[model samples]
Target: MAQRELVCPEEMAHLVERFNYAPAVKVGQMVYAAGQVGRDSEMNVIDSSLEDHITAAWENVGKVLAAAGCGYEDIVEMTTFHVDLQEQLPTFLAVKDKFIPRQDVPPAWTAIGITELTFPGQLVEIKVIACVPDAA
Candidate 1:
């Protein structure tokens, strides 16, 4: 069997601690992306607002997917964790709309409220699963 290829964005190393889980892993045609927070390239919190954080988190997910040669359309599932789901749902949906157009198929999604995240002031985290194109 051929070895699978793994991929990640350069920003991921700065965003996640070295001792923590890797940003993304590919096995066969599936890519599993680690939970992404609202941190910038330096791992510093970007915005204090829940809406800002949610948008940043999703953007980070997109970066990782792009590195893996995938896109939002290739995502099959997503799991989101927020400190306050009720307060952030509308904002999350609004940001989601920017990425997933009405004509595109939306991926399976789940949202859960959490007490906290790995870093202080972090408001949202997102995990994604994407399918890679078959090798010709």
Candidate 2:
């Protein structure tokens, strides 16, 4: 049986100490990360241009991935929730290309369009699942 372990990196300790939730959970070779939005290190939402908004979200996601000892290449799946998908896709995809690995077969991705998110002035949120060899 694979044992479940809380995978919280010191960089994201606020998630556990303040938010009362692990930024990500690790079980054996798999890791499930929480959705990451384009907020500051202190979690304050940022009001910025479309590219910057998308960039920040991916940066947060990268922090979560680092916490799990994984890289973008280790990501097997990703899901994103957007407040304005149609309007943001081009900029979002452009920014995504900068983060996601250019693998022969890329990770599975699903994007959802929605009206709003948990916070005001937020634009995008992304979460990912990574599968690594001997990750535990």
Candidate 3:
């Protein structure tokens, strides 16, 4: 089996100390990130407006990708879980576009609307898969 390198940001040290999951992992040129929610450094999921939660989640994803030596443009796949998909998609996309402005060939995407999430009031979670060119 190929070895996978765990990707954890120093900012999320508290989560690592408590949980068994890495925020993401890198194998060869690919990086797979766990779903990022609007959680604080201490793992407190924020209960805020959808826009705020979405913005925070994307920022967290950015942090993880950066730690894994990847960038937004390198992302090739993304999955989003939402509490109210129908009502919030427009707003979510508006906020997401702010971060991913260039969509010439946007990553493959999947968005799921569910009745609830792990946290009662948490509204959004995002996971990503990205790739970098193999080293020379």
Candidate 4:
């Protein structure tokens, strides 16, 4: 079995310390990132607007991926949790497309609707699984 490595970027150190959970974990070439919300560098939830929140969440996800030695293009599977499914899905999709602009072969995605999230005003949370290339 491959050893598990916790992936926590410096900006997100507060989360790991406060919540006692790793933002992402890397085992071999697979990086499993936890749900990333629209939080700032100080871990404050960004809720100015749906689009802004969604974009921030994606950026947070990107940070976690980078810490795991991965990138958005390396993501093989993605799962999003939305507070307001019908009302916010279209906006979320638009923001998501910007981060993952590969129209040819995009990663597998699943969008889920939820009532609420960990923090107030946090509309969406994104989680992903990336497969990084083996550095020989």
lDDT of 3 by residue, 1-136 (tens): 8889989999976677677879998998899999998777766777667788888889999999989987788899999998889998998899888877587899999999988877767888899999965557
Residues 1-136 of candidate 2: C-alpha lDDT, one tens digit per residue: 7788787767678768877897888898799988889888877787768788789889888888887888788889999999989999999999999999799989899999999998898999998999765634
Indicate the worst ten consecutive residues by lDDT in candidate 1: 12-21
Q: What is the TM-score of each candidate against the true structure?
A: 0.86, 0.92, 0.92, 0.94
Q: Model 3 residue 90 lDDT? A: 100
**Model 3 misplaced stretches (Cα beyond 4 Å):** 133-136
> Which candidate, 1 or 3, would have the higher lDDT against the true structure?
3
Off by over 4 Å in 1: 1-4, 14-17, 103-105, 134-136
lDDT of each: 0.82, 0.87, 0.86, 0.90
- Misplaced by over 4 Å in model 4 are none
lDDT of 4: 0.90
| Top candidate, metric lDDT | 4
Whole-model lDDT for model 1 versus the true structure? 0.82
Which is the leading candidate under TM-score?
4
Please write out the lDDT profile of model 4 over residues 1-136, one tens digit for every residue.
7799999999888878799999999998999999999989886888788899999999999999988887888999999898989999889889988998675777898989999999788888899999997787
Quick one: ranking by lDDT, best first? 4, 2, 3, 1
Alpha carbon deviation, residue 96, candidate 1 (Å): 1.1
Q: Which clashing pairs does model 4 show? A: none
